[model samples]
Target: MWAFLHRFASPPHFYRLSGRMAPWLGWACLGTMLGGLYGGLVAAPPDYQQGESYRIIFVHVPSAWMSLFIYVVMAGASAVALVWRMKLAEVVAVASAPVGASFTFLALVTGSLWGKPMWGTYWVWDARLTSELILLFLYFGVIGLHSAIEDRRTASRAAGLFAIIGVVNIPIIHFSVEWWSTLHQGPTVTKLSAPSIHLSMLVPLLLMAVAFKLFYVTVLLMRARCEVLERERNAGWVRALIAREGSE
Candidate 1:
């Protein structure tokens, strides 16, 4: 398994494989996303308390989940890059930053929209909200720090170190509601016991979550492949790949 991973992690091979896989991932993302949207918006019944406003959960909850989940992925990849000096891990870490930030921004916006009716306000410095806000800034810091330096290797190491250190906040974001008296609602879908959500609602939420994960991987592969080409522009394989493209 390790040998296979080491082989697959080669820049040229990963680029080729990811290019072939992207279309399939795109189709899957589209199908799952459509199903989730239809289920969330059309089929599922409204919440007794929140009504139509609750529909935003289909987007907000998934974005919020991805916001945290992607950071952990970045931090893990960063650790690998830092410890093993893996170029692909470094690329994955840097590539994930922007996508993670976008999701965090979406989560914050949707949460505010949902909060308006539920909390009688658009924003608050609650534990989860504040931690999530910090998470966005963390993503920004990684992207900015990486770009600030001209040397790609040096930049990735610096950014990877930053990502590893910033991982302390992930658990804080996940457990904020339980750790403090926050305005954000506690987890209903991920509790240890049976989910509090109805079957109708839970199914769509799960589908949306799966779609988000697929979307992230699809985008990450696309971004990472481009990053690889830029990093390997002078390599023989890259030149050969360019020749092939030109011939076609």
Candidate 2:
């Protein structure tokens, strides 16, 4: 298993593998997103309390979930790059930052849209919201730090350290509602027992979450492939690959 894993640490191998997998993942993401959106928007009944405004959760909840999920992935890749000095891992970590940042931004926007009708305000300094906002800044910090450094390896190391340090905030974001008084609601789908949401609602929510994960995989692979090509531009294999494509 270690040998198999180590083989992909090679940039050429990962570049080829990711290119082959991206198309399939993209199609799957599209299919799942369409299904989820249809079910969430058309099939599911309105909430007894919030009514149509609650429909925003189809987009809001998935984006919020992806925000945390992608950060964990970024941090994990950063750790591998730091410990193993793996180029592919560094590419993955950097490729994921912008995507994660986009998700975080989407979550904040959708949450604000949802809040206007529910909370009677567009923004608040509630614990959960505040922590999530901090997360967006952390993402910006990583991106800015990575771009500012002249050396790619050094930049990866710097960003990796920051990501590792920032991971502490994930737990804070997750438990913010439970640990403190906040306008945000607690977990409905991730509870210890059965989820509190109805099955019809739960299915679409779960589907959307899965679709978002697939979307991340699809975009991450594409971005990582681009990063790999840029880093490997001077390599013989890369030049040969480009020549072969041009010839064809």
Candidate 3:
């Protein structure tokens, strides 16, 4: 077990493994996204109250969920790099930032679009919204800090620390709607009494979430491969890998 684990930890081995994983993940993501969209947009019934407007939740909720999920993943990667001094871990955390931030931005924009019709306003200072906004800032800060530092090792370490420290905000962002009375709605799918939403709605929401997760995995592997190449540029295997890729 230890031998297998150590062998996999080697950069060259991991790089090769990740390359093989990427295409599978990509196809899976594409398939899941198609299925989920079909289920959400066409198959799901309209909400009794919100009517067609509730359809937006299919996109809005999943993007928002991804925004939060990716940040946690980035934070976990950052922690691994900081603690174990893993270069690959740092690369993963760095690579994940922009993707996570983009998702966060998508969430905010979609939420705003969904909000206008429901709340009669495009913006609000509600707990959930405000906390999510702050999450975007955190993503920005991590990315900016990583770029600002001249030394890659130092930069990664610094960013990793920031990511770990900033993790506190995640819980606050998650529970804010419940912790304090706010305009934002409380837990719908996460409720203990059973999901507050019906199966028709729930199925789509879950499907979208699965789609988003698959999408993230596909993108992350691509980014990770890029990162591996860049970081391992001077290595013999990298040159061979590049030559092979170029030939193809």
Please rank every candidate by lDDT, starting with the best: 1, 2, 3
- lDDT string for model 2 (118-168, tens) is 999999999999999999999999999999999999999999899989999
lDDT of 3 by residue, 164-217 (tens): 888998999889988999887887887689888989778878978888888888
Pitting candidate 1 against candidate 3, the one with the higher lDDT is 1
Model 3, stretches more than 4 Å misplaced? 244-248
Predictions in order: lDDT? 0.95, 0.93, 0.87
Model 2 C-alpha RMSD vs. true structure (Å) is 0.9
Model 3 deviation from native, Cα RMSD in Å: 1.5
Give the lowest summed-lDDT range of ten residues in model 1.
182-191
| Deviation (Å) of 148 in candidate 1 | 0.5
Candidate of highest lDDT: 1
Candidate 1 Cα deviation (angstroms), residue 77: 0.5
TM-score for all models, in order of appearance: 0.98, 0.98, 0.95
